[model samples]
Target: MGPTREQFIQYAPAALAVAAAAAGPWSAIAAGAAGAGAWAISVSAPALRSLIACGITATGCGIAAHQVLASGMNPLFALGLAVPAGAAALAHHRNLAGELLPALPATTTAAAGAGQSSQAQVITAYWMEFISGPTQTEGRKLIQAGAVLAHLGLDVGDEHMSFTGIITLPQGQQVRVKPADIASVYGIPASQVEMGDPKHYAPNALPVTVHLRKAPEQPQIAAGIPTTVEELWAAHVAIPDGAMPGTALTLTRYDGPLDWEGIATRERKAIGAVNLQDLAGNLDLSSIQIALAPTDKPSQMGVRVMKEHALMHGTMLSDVVDELAMDSRGYVRLGTYIDANAALVPLAQPGSGARHLYLVGGSRSGKSGILEQILLSAHKSRIAVILASPQAGTIAGAGLAAHCGDGLDEAMGALRLAYAVMLDREARYRTPRFPFTDPLIEFILDEAHMLLLASSQYHLEAKAIVEQLTRRSLKRGIGVVLATQTPLAEDLGNSTVIRSQLLIGGGAVFLRCAKGQGSLVGTNAVEGAEGIDLSMIPPQWPGQYAKIADRDMSGLDTEAAARPEDGTFGLGYLLTPGSQAVQFRSLHLDVAPVSLAGSLPPVAVEDCEAWRHREAIMRTPMVDQRGKNLIGSLADLLTKAEQGPPSAAQQGQPAGPQQAQAHPASSAGSAGGDARELLKPRILELLRSGSSPMTAETIARKLGTSVKHVRPRLSELKGRDEVINENTLWRAA
Candidate 1:
């Protein structure tokens, strides 16, 4: 039975004192005095209080015992004396016969031992759980005790009991199993299970069965969707199973009757019926031949029916009649009709597989804009571009500014460097195993002809670079796109290079250039071929173009559809947009007026003097082939004349009667003449150095020249050098 409230109240003072003494020294003294007073009160009613106080006193003793225990005193000593003494006295007064002793259990000691054992187990379990659960496990545990209890079983009152146990098999081996009625007892619904059997609860279900009942065969799939000869030929002839006549049967299930006229119309449009005649003229019969042949197998006929249907509509039979002539090469027309309104069409097809492109047209002929579009497309594809322009700022904002340089020299240098980098990158991947993966880097040099002309003096070098790029760079994924206003044969270099390119341009020269080179072959080239007069090219239309490819018109149509708005077309493909394009302009060089002034100061002339000295040393003459003193003799004569006399050898050398008579006069005259001639240039140089422009007469007078003699000498100087003839006033030659 639990202690009563009155018993608790009667022992409150002692209980408080015990609790206080456990807390602090000051409280211990106060609580002891209070407890003594309570004990004194109990003495007055000792019998009644002792019974009630015994339980409270036991609780108080436990609390006080804790204080002694915490201070390293033996709590068992205090408990053994106080608890047993009280219980013994109480037992002595009580009737023992046929009665259960109402004494307190030895719970404090038992609890301490049990708690210590349990804490030790908990600590061991914590370490084991940490290591086993988190560190050592390779994968998640399939079953956890806590999860099994929560999910698989009914809750019991026991807090520590897990809803887990082991199952012992007949062999006496134990297998851990969480009791899960849902998983262990019940099976999933039949439909929810995927058992490989035809009959339920059949132990000997056959793995596979073949029923004797007749079954309908599946129909062929070639009955629907469009197909062409190349596809059919590939499926039938090239592949083993593709050509089976039995399998070739087409079973087309339609919702209603077929629209024969509509199919015919589509076939006509796809085959370009109206352009059949044009196509016929352009067809390369030597390369490909087109002819009609009847077959019991209409599907085997493939595109032949489509081609005929197209001819019947609007296309002339002559157009594809030649196409039917070819037998070896496989051809497939992807799509038909030009979609001028489709935005994505242009981006779908790039240039025909040609490396070089030639674009020519007059101003306002859409040459530049067309070139820009092609370049923009190339740029978007991250193709390396090298542009050369004499006109600065022309292609500034076109993503090519950084690659562009000042003039032909710089432009060529940049191109050479770009080529070298590409080569180096390729060479770095030259190992037997590894290979280069870079896409072709195309070079678009607008006004390329200008570079050709500007570097004409360096023609051999220019040609070598261009030729190297053209010949070697193709395999390395390098190509050149050149555009010009003129199709000069010299600029483009013989028709060999021009013909190899995908040509785009309008005008007589362009057509003549293409036609002469045999690049223009089809009816388009022939019909408009005559209208390609360069003189008649209109300024308003800039995107007109002529296309050529090794494939049929279908290929051209596909290519046209593949071009992108911001994309670049190959050479000769003119680009047309609906709006005006803004052009970038660069600053021009300013020329300053020439000044006629006093001669430069001596110090300022140092550089000029050095240049003169270098020039003199370079110009100094060496011994002639005959070992004659070429410049030395001239120098010696000047020295002798400066000293005012001829040496003895000079006087005695010519003493024949006529020579002796002529010697004195000739020697005297020659000395003055040599000196005068030597000083004449200096005198003229000084006269021209003055502020005012000088005439030949003024210059001659200043230099003490005879008028008649000065004019001829001045004429000689003017003829031999660049003399400033400003308003007929002479400066210097």
Candidate 2:
């Protein structure tokens, strides 16, 4: 039925009224804003393309404004209407944000080097390569994704979606997806989808990358028709039934807080292994980091590939014995980080004027083992080592240290001797006529917390000596390596200055430690390291070690219950000077520890005069070391002590004249007085000779007898006036 002129004329009055209003002053502004907003929405669908939206919106707004000014409406009226029109447009966009829709994220990637640099249309035998669009196969995959998304109730459009070609590192195309929505596509009830945060995966998701791989084992990962179908609908991912040559896998990173429980339990569903080695020339596997990305509900995890395949394995120091010589860089090569992309850490900082190396770690964290390796290597380089440990460990018993101390009081004598050496060197370096030795001294103080933090009369003296050593000992050819479990300043006798000085020039190694230890190691150590967290280092039980330690005397080497897939022992973070902090494993000397004790003499810290000076001042001066091998390989020293009480034969070296033949006229001792006897006179000789009461360990170390033998004798002596005992510290009466 065609409308006649009479029918059209019946609605003329309403038409005339509408036409008159269209010509009104605000008409152009209203039309312009509406047109511009529509343009913005159409182009910015799926996701807002800011640059294109800005240019398109401004063009539409200007044209509409020009039209109103030309239609006899005053320019002022159009200008006044612009404010409300702009506000309305903004409200429209704010309402449309965060809505999911089908997208061509593939547009962000380009097929680089696919065709010639400059193209001639006639030369197009490889037509697909010449085109900027995805191939037919890719286009079909994109269409499937759009259809699947639509079925899941998302407002997916029939836009030309393409095959998700390949995703490169750092930045890849992103698509908005919800785990529940993905579940719906696979016929799984949306309620079955587990998530900690529903909005997390929905807001911005990286487009799935279908990395083709084949499982060489049974019970393939991502098993089941539903799971395989969902992955296929998403992007034709790998099939799980082994019907196809390559299995499909997508990557998801789990970036969360690092902790044992978290690392072990964090869920990373993506799994597959690719033999990139087969594609040798075409692909470099080293550049490919095979780690997963994030998921819908992210629980902070401390995950690393270290436990199963730790970088440091069966290789021993004996294998690389030449490392004993200082390298061209003046540093000893320790081990590398736990990454295939990792290298090594040095024993000392070169050209930094003998700046110290500070290491912090908890028990069995490899701090002591690392110290043992360092001392041995340093000695091989002709560097003198004065090894002092307040707590007895394998390092103290390692036999050949020029001067070794096992208790706090004995450690102080080593410290005093080191101080004297530093002073002597300082004076000698001043005289132009003096000859300089290339050999430097390394004073390694193991378990330093007791010396620095314990409450005792010598606390102030110990602090003052350490403070001097840290502040002024460098450049004088001496460096102090202080290792402690807790690096906190308050626990270090509230001596923050000492801590600062120790790590000032970026020299610190933090091994697998407890919470907050790495952060407290000092600001300078981890300054430039982008993502270093020492507390994240997984604790390794001895049973987890792939290679068993030869010795287990300190209880540190005792085995503990562990998982079958564990092996990351001696792992931690080390910040090399000028290098960023990263995970590092301290090396191990493969040889039996006791056998290495007789290898070489440590650079002697004590000369004849210094030895006499120590014996005179030190209450429990560790003797048998007056210019000869003092405390020779505690290897056998400890063995003979365990057999029975003390004897002159137990002494490793000859004592000085003053310390020798102590009261040969004593009647209580009926033995073959071979210049010495155990317990009584030796205890009095130590106390009467110096200032400071000493503990049983200190008295044992001084008298060259075990604490079990010295404790009873000290009790017996206290009954008479031979020695006085106060709270376990013994002194002469």
Candidate 3:
């Protein structure tokens, strides 16, 4: 039961004494005690008890001081007594049930250490929090922590309790907690934690780092850089003491400490032991920019180190660079230095003038599109184009239709004629004594495989002609652009020819084939391996190409810089000489029909009638050589009869009663039973000629016989293997 006022008053003295002991002042204690009693009443009545607590505390202190002076007590002792007494009174007034709690102890602050020792301490703390929090919010906090850790390169070991530490929280506050605690508190798995330093983890712990380390940095490929097989060998031998020639390196921590001798040796070998100066002259490095390493990971070491030297300046280790290169241009461009003394020099324009280019890619892989762009560029240059497509309608309606030819022979002939025409024009105005400029004529063959197919002899001839033209035609300003779906070097006859003419490659097979020959641009020029889809290509972007050549610099660049969304260089751009640059565009041509070698002749009306009458006679069934002879003789008789040898009422043609009544029989002496057989031979003989289809009446007139007699014979002849009547046309089968 609740205590009454009198019962509360009865305990007041005891409460005051306790308060005096705790607070240190008798008067203060008394005041606090009184306030507690009043507070209890106020709990039952409100305003009165609330006012009593304040009044007693103030009044008791003053009264206690006065009592101390009057009673001659120590003032310090009085004040000390009042302190605890006041605290006790307040507690009672507030209706606190338990004993008053003690003041907080001072806490020690220290800096957290690092390494294994600190790790252990942090781990223990992590466990405690992990086991304590088991709600959704805590779990979310854990995930955030893990994310931060990953970003910082930290590897939170597999133990759920391993990430316990003070994490930097929002508003610059630090919360010392375990990852598992945050996970448990937030109700999520530790994996979801997206907080912490990613770099804190060892190299082995990060897949990206591991992959970066394994990836090799390709050597700098420079246009017009003299290099040879011997130099490549020297470069390899000159590799730095600690690194292998082909080992991966990054630019993060590398200084120019490469083994120059080794690198020179390798360079020599790569160029087939050619003279170093000569090799350098043939390697072009224009359009390439060297980038410094951004990170210090071991995986990046190869790229970083190589980037430090002038020799290794163009070498890069990132796939992004390669991707940017390819995506920037519609095709991969390779820079090759031309050697004046080289036999293949004549195949291309002298000193990087204009070069004939061949492009290869598989079906639906943008071969045609790339070719179209190339042709368009040439056209802009005012180069005359001669195009051919055996698949007639396939590329019709495309701007290229003007260049398409009928068949392989016709195509080759057209090219030859164009050449001859150019020659004639050149000869008329320009001789060795007098030079005149003329528009260049470029022959572009789309679907080149049609001309290279094994079944066509014309394909072989075309190949020979193309080879000869490519080898010698550049002097005459004649260029050829041959595009095909196949990249087989043997199919094109000579590997040297393909290498000499190949300017671009797209699609998987074409790239693979090019790579096999070490002809493709480096991986550094392409987007990362994951950037491109392996299965199918996307819709054609007007100028998109796997690689492109820098005509002026004679260097290859992977992709263009222009953004596709703006309709600039959507696919990529090919920079020509001077101020000229062309964006690639795809051709929208219709499918064409296959070309046939010969044409068919037309039929005449007279031939039609003669064939029909002959077929009619042949449809009848008849036998007997003598009867056949009679029918044969009937053809001469009908011709004369038609010419009016005898009139219908003439004496010789008089209708005899017996002649009209009885069927005609052969003089060869077969009676009525065999007589029906006579008509069969004549009809069979006529039908065997496969002349024409005819009715019984027509056959009877041709055979000089009655229709009634010929109809049965024609049926008999049909039953035998003598003839066939199809669509009313009688012919020998």
| Model 3: per-residue Cα lDDT at residue 510 | 26
lDDT of 2 by residue, 477-526 (tens): 67888888855664466776787777673377877667766453244233
lDDT of model number 3: 0.37
Candidate 2 regions off by >4 Å? 1-315, 339-353, 394-397, 431-435, 454-457, 516-518, 521-526, 529-533, 541-566, 593-599, 606-608, 617-733
What's the true lDDT of residue 516 in model 1?
A: 33
The best candidate in terms of TM-score:
2
Error of 3 at 417 (Å): 2.8
Return the candidate ranking by lDDT, descending: 2, 3, 1
* Model 1 lDDT per residue over 447-474, tens place: 6565566445434444444554555444
Q: Tens-digit lDDT track for model 3 on 384-496?
A: 55676555644432353234455655555454443333333322322222122544456666666665665554544455446545654454555666666544454464334
lDDT for model 1? 0.34
Predictions in order: lDDT: 0.34, 0.48, 0.37
Estimate the TM-score of every prediction: 0.26, 0.41, 0.31
Ranking by TM-score: 2, 3, 1
Task: Write down the TM-score for model 2.
Answer: 0.41
